[model samples]
Target chain A: MLHFKAEIKENIPVSKNHYLLTFTPLAKTPVPLPGQFYMIGIGNSCDPLLKRPFSILTKSDDSIRILYRIKGKGTTLMKEMKTGTVINVMGPLGNSYPIPKKKHTPLIIAGGIGIASVFYLAEKLKGKAIVLYGARGKHELLMLDELRGLVKELHISTDDGSYGKKGTIIDLLNEFHVNDKHLIYACGPKGMIRAVSEFALEKGLKGYISLEENMACGIGACMGCAVKTLKGYKRVCKEGPVFNIKDILW
Target chain B: MNLEVSIGKLRLKNPVMTASGTFGYGEEYSDFVDLNSLGAVVVKGISLTPMQGNPPPRICETPCGMLNAIGLQNVGLKKFLKEKLPYIRNFDTKLIVNILGSTVNEYVRLASALDEARVDGIELNVSCPNVKKGGIAFCADSRTLGRLVSKVRKSVNHSTLIVKLSPNVTDIKEPAKAAEEAGADAVSLINTITAMAVDLKTRKPVLKNITGGLSGPAVKPIALRMVWEVSRTVNIPVIGMGGIMNAEDALEFMLAGATAVAVGTANFINPSSTSDILEGIKIYMKENKINDISEIIGGLLIDNPDD
Candidate 1:
């Protein structure tokens, strides 16, 4: 991948602890895929040495948008970054989400912060999908308008009953009663993935899960993010940050 | 506009040198960086024999740095001379070989093999934190450090030898003095400090190796302090490093008694850190109206207890 000193064009709050960052690259670089991530540095502060990895929420010819939550020092620094400030970025790394060939009934499930990945996925497959989004409350329910515009059937559920259906996102998924003919995709907290993975497995539905781990060198060289699977320990950064539901051990 | 540095008799066009281990044999970063523009490329720590290094989870992120426990994973001196050294010779920049050994004899053997090759210099990697044996073992005692350097010194005639010191010791001066007495032409300090990152949730050590060397901007202050201390202790030229990301930081090392500086963890964060530091140093010199940076060596005033 090529390293570009990018300038921040926009930074806006999408939800609590989450913001959308748009960067304009200085040079021509590789276009980011739906699930691919970028390693970004916010400022010259000593708190962050390496760039923080973020999912490519959207991509265009010259600019790339990253959706991230203010969880740690790196993200906090990123939150403070002003528009027009330059930061170093090296990425469009990791594997992308598999694109569906035919227009199968698309079933998109997002848990809590997991909604970030589906932004780009929905942007690509707009008007031909169904989105089931779950969050703790209305404030945490991110990109609802965007997802609603993209999908045909939009289902919203909050744990605190602040949104459409008062229950867990998975609870709402169980009530959908969709047939096994649909292709499913999901991202969110680990617990949500395990729940959705088990549910999708029993229902005999085709689904993919975007997993998360604390990665040092987000490339394969570090081998920090190892997930147990049928093929033994596989690197999440290389093998599959996005794995088919059946491939996951949990 | 070609900037280079000469460590003793060996000459490097640019003062920007890649610290060992972060750069894998001067080849890993070639795709991202112009290897020839660098002052020198020091490969990973090579032992007398091949090493597997530590188990999985070899690295972890610290406050503003990284802890790495890659226990000198190399193909040994024989393989290096046969394979790695020949390929490096084809490049334009200087190649400094960082060697780690278990004993004095092993250091001698490694040095002898390096002397036979077309390499520019040898940086005795006596401070690698990854290995439990032969790496930091040589740097613990001044007497042993001197003996290790002397053995390598006597073995190699053509190559300039630099003894890299560890920061884990109580007093850095003792080892710096010992290396000087052993006829080391130059010295580089400090290597990563022994550190461990614990997962608060799991209540277990983050890295598989319980301990690893900490590097990056987090260690910059500590490295600068040690460089200042070691430079004052030894008369030989000192190559300073640890957490240096920019030219101002590199200049800080130079002012604190380092003849040159190495950019390690910064390379992981920014591919252009080395070049940026080089450019910054030149611009700093121009802005400060300083013709030569050599005038600023040991510029810090020693704190006075009885003023």
Candidate 2:
């Protein structure tokens, strides 16, 4: 909800085609929530016109991290940036993970790059959650070493059989026994989210899902990122990038 | 320090109005921008009925600008008055609603509906299709523009009618004169230039709608040229826009011929863009020892060998 200049401490490749950007705030800010995001922009350039929105992968007292893959024109510029570059970041935007009132078994389900938003949620749970991550292959399963130490039980799967249990994350869900009393949290591709939402609903587990939609203002002002819910069209950047699975129409 | 300038009967506190679609009814950036400090806040396009905009991939970045096919997505007139008007009325600044429709009757109906409404003015977006004429835009043809605007001008009694012209036309002056002759109090341009972006990988257009309206710094020069041309042809006040991101850009529009300028796509770049531009204008006026903003309007220098 605040805008400040943050200097990039580092932006190094963490995995194939992925980078881990670490930046320190030029101004003081309250600690961002687990699912909050930042609208990051390079200095003065107008071509990429608007700042790109990225969820906070992790954070510490002096620095914050964002995980991104080179998607288009904007990230292409980001990939070549040198360290110590001053990036204009408007953050900790959007709503956060639905923290339950009482402690219970937390099931963190993530697919591919969706793991960027969930890593902090795991930290908030104090290594007491069970995380299930799915990727196309072993190479795509990013931040595994860092992620393994954060969760109590870490389950991984790769479609090409180069890693643990082969198949989609949905197939992994079928193999694993999700406890009846657990609360579910999910993020990933639309199909993956839809399947997990359906799976969680059928299991009668309370859950929230993070959505990825092309955004304009990233802060709900533009009304560009619209998602149809039971109530009709709502802004993903405003109403939520996070929503209860039960309330979402699809 | 006197920044107030009159656009017909409507006097703005300053010349900075947040462009339609960029400001989002003044609620989205209320935390970041001081709405009351602005001269005006123009909300997005509202049609006769609710509209679901184009499918995804609606925006694509270009060289110093961006193309968007939001397709004028809005809550419709009924919903806008019911759900949005009350919230907008709370602001101390002038409120101008930008409205669009497919036909002449729709414009008149909307004009009649808001004639007595609490808002200050109405900006007609003539960039939309004239459905009765098989989707030719009202702004594209001068006669159609004259007919639709004059009929709309007759229906609204309490509000100033400002016609927003598109730059897609060949001779922008023709429509500006047409609007003036049809009783429009003021006119604003250029909505956006028609353009397209292609994805090299897919070998297809980037936006779902193949083409969209381009806005931002890339269109500023083209918009300035049109504003200069239209202002000379029409006696009515001209509100210029297109790639107006900063106070310098606003001053450039004013110097060219715009009575007022709206900050458009820059709102996405900086959430507080409106306020920053307003502040910059104030500083410029102060440093220049200018007492009033009117002194700077149409102050451009054009030279000829004879002179």
The lDDT of each candidate is 0.80, 0.86
Q: Tens digits of per-residue lDDT for model 1 on B49-162?
A: 776655556777887888887666667777877787777777888889888777777788888888877468899988877775657788988898888888789998998899
In the range B236-300, model 2's lDDT, one tens digit per residue, is 99999999989999999999999999998999888898899999998999999999999999999
* Model 1 deviation from the true structure expressed as Cα RMSD, one decimal place: 4.9
TM-score of 1: 0.78
lDDT of 1 by residue, A1-250 (tens): 4677899999988877889899899877887778777788767766666677778887877799877888877788788889999988887777878887584677889988787887788788867778899989999988777677877788899999988899998999999977876788899999999999999989998978888876655554444466667755665766768888888876
Shift in Å, residue B128, candidate 1: 3.1
Which runs in model 1 stand beyond 4 Å of their true positions?
A98-110, A125-134, A137-139, A148-186, A190-250, B1-4, B25-28, B46-90, B99-117, B130-135, B146-159, B181-185, B196-212, B287-307
**Residue B180 Cα positional deviation in candidate 2, in Å, after optimal superposition:** 0.9
Error of 1 at B254 (Å): 1.9
